[model samples]
Target: MKTDVLIAGAGPVGLTMASELSRYGLSVRLVDKNTQRTDKSKAIVLWARTLELINRMSPNCADRFIETGLKTESVNILSGSEHIGHADMKEVDSKYKFVVMIPQSDTERLLEEHLATFNIKAERQTELTDFKETSDGVTYVLKHADGSEETAEASWLIGADGAHSIVRHKLNKEFHGSTLLSDWMLADIYLTGVQGTPAINIYWHADGILALFPLQGTRHRIIANVGESSGPIGEGNRPAPTVEDIQRVLDTRGPGGIKAEDSVWRSNFSINERKVDDYRSGRVFVAGDAAHVHSPAGGQGMNTGMQDAFNLTWKLALVSRGICQPEPLLSSYSAERSPVAKVLLEFTGRATEAALLRGGVKQSIRNHVASLVLGFAPVTHTMANLLSEISIGYSDSPLNAHTQHPRHGVKPGKRALIRENEPPVGFGDAPRFALFAESNNLPSALLLKYSALLEATPRAPLSPDSLSLVRPDGYVALATKSGDWNAVDAYLNQFLPKAS
Candidate 1:
């Protein structure tokens, strides 16, 4: 059998890759070794930037997530019973300002449903056992639950297969990082007598860190650091936290007078901070946990993985359809996303270390500094943007281009703001750049020449002096002075097929 893309795994990241590729009219075969999706409520929050990317996939698709999940408007930091500071989600510049709290299971189900609209369904109980990449495509083998094997060919292959990825292993790429020795407990349960707005609460206690994430209705998720681990880092080896265990932590760490009951899920696991230096190897690519996994401090693990899918698929679609060359266009994927993952790992690692500080003068000093720093509006706003991932940008991306006299507004490689009632960038079947400039300012000749790669009409510019070309994934590709058509032309020329 033949397909345009062969995706391994069916988690949120894999589902996202399949959905984006299929939405772009590519043939996709999604497979997973597991017969069913996860029932556990892993990865509990979807940041604003992720929701904006989902909005581009289809109109009202992000709305489905917003409706089904809980919305958190702010995050409060506390030292035992005393309030330290808080970050307001409203400070984020995106239209979807608040973070949506949805379980990984529901996220997968929703992504699968969206992919089904394009007539693609994930093949369960099927695993990718081996593969060999050729010049033009990848030839792979799949093993079924019934001990049967099938050979297939695809123009490309993606390993969203996770940390234990067979595809990543086959590529001989090392997942470079270490697992922390500390064990943390996670619980999803119903809580009564919990005070405050629908917000994420983090309590810095003398013992460890305890966080409460509000879910739909009366349900909440609790995470706490227990102590040093005596065993390995896998979740299977760690004992599950009982309701009593959760209540004990809450009573000791959380703000006074909160009861934990009706437990739904509980598990203890160690944090692994690992990432691959490159996201791509020849015609194959690894995303999500296959490429990077970090601390859960910022709730960025799943969102980062999903964004990796968002960033790679548009480029893949353009190249696969012969609309662009395979050189710089494909190489830019790793160049763009790898740095973002590196930053995330460092940020999450710092956050985890800060929260795990043992009680002493150092812990007191840390709490004092955090409270003092977070009290500043700018500090809190920056934290909000970082945590929600609205501030992520590829300023150093190879795909970024600019003229000498570029106007000042949104610079090259920054995300253009998604305004209300306006259609997002990259909002169609074909992967094309959206032009942000006055219609009258754009020359018909320039539009005609790159019509295959550019959006038909130019939207209003950020400033009258700026002419911006935003990529299909909504990052700035070219930011030049208004009426500088030469820069735009030169930028698009790089992706054009070379003469033989």
Candidate 2:
């Protein structure tokens, strides 16, 4: 069998890749070795930027997530019983201002259901055992649960297969990074006496950091550092924490009066901060845990991976359909997303280290500094934007183009503000850029020449002096003087087929 794209692993990242490709009318086959979806609540918070991107997938697609998941409006930082500072999600610059607290299991299920709407279901119990990539495409072998092997060909291969990805291994890419020696425990259970509204509460205690993330109703997720590890870092190396163990930590570290009961899940794990330098190798690419995995500190691990799929698929769709050139368009995937992972790794690593501050003098100074810094409105606002991922941009991307005109308003490579009641930039079966300028300012000849690369009608411009060409993924591709049609044409020409 043959397809346009062969996606390995049916987790959230792979599901997202398949969904976006299929939405663009591409043939996609998603395969996973697991027989069933996960029941564990794994990576739990879907930030505002992720929800905004999901909205572009289809009408009311994000609404399904908002309805099913719990909405958290703020993150509070505390030093034992005293409140240090807080970052309010209401201040985030997006329509979906609040972070949605949904389980990874539910996220995968919803993504799979969305993929089904495209008439594509994940091939479960089927694993990618081997693959060889030629100059034009990839030919691979899949091993079935019953021991039958099937050979298939695809125009491209995606490894969303996760940390132990066979695809990444086959490409001979080194995942270089170190693992922290400290151990941490995670618990999902019914709890009482968690104070205040449904917010993320982080208590910086002398022992370690204790964070309580509220789920639907009375359920909550608790994570705490439990000192340095004595054994190797892997599952079953440390025993799962009991309810009593959780309660003890909560009593000692939390802001008092929190009772733990009716435990649902409990596990202990070590944090690994590892990533590959490049996300793509020839016709194959790795995403999610396959490419990078960082500290769960800010719950960015899953959202970053999902956004990787979002960024890569639209470019893939355009190239595979012969609408765009393959060079810079495909190469931009790694160039753009690799920096994001690099930044994320550094940010999460710093956060983890800050939380694990041991010495009393260092802890006191860290707490004092954090309290003072977060007390500023601008600091808290920036914190909120970073946590929700609203501030992520590819300013240095090879795809970015700008005119010599003085920069004003949203610059090239920044995300255009997603306004209410307005359809997103990439909302249809075809991946096309949206032009944001007065209809009269648009040259009819320009639209006619690059119809496959641009939207038919121009929306309202950011400013009367400036026009913007936004990518299918909502990033600013070209920002220049309002009447600069020549700049727009030149920008579009770079991606158009050579014959065109």
lDDT of 1 at 439: 69
- How far residue 316's Cα lies from its native spot in candidate 1, in Å, is 0.5
Summing lDDT over every window of 10 consecutive residues in candidate 1, give the lowest-scoring window.
402-411
Indicate which candidate wins on lDDT.
2
Error of 1 at 361 (Å): 1.0
Give the clash total for candidate 2. 0
lDDT of 2 at 274: 95
Model 2: per-residue Cα lDDT over 1-500, one tens digit each: 56999999999999999999999989999999999878899999999999999999999799999998999999998888788889999999998879899988899989989998988999999999999997789999999999999998999999999999999999999999998898899999999998788999988999999999999999999999887886877545578999999999999998889899898899998899999999998899999999999998889999999999999999999999999889899999999999999999999999899988888999989988989999999999999999999999999999998577648458888999887777999998998999887677577899999998899888888777788989999999888878888988999998888974
lDDT of 1 by residue, 1-500 (tens): 57999999999999999999988889999999999988988999999999999989998689999988999899998987788889899898888879999988889889988998998889999999999999889999999999999998999999999989998899999899999889899999999889978999999888999999999999999999888886766664567888999999999998878898798988888899999998899989999999999999889999999999999999999899888899798899899889999999999999899999886898889988988999999999999999989899999988888567655557888888776777888887888898887666568998898888998888888777788889998888888777778888999999988888
RMSD of 1: 1.1
lDDT of the candidates, in the order given? 0.90, 0.91
lDDT for model 1 comes to: 0.90
TM-score of each: 0.98, 0.98
* Residue 115 displacement in candidate 2 (angstroms): 0.9
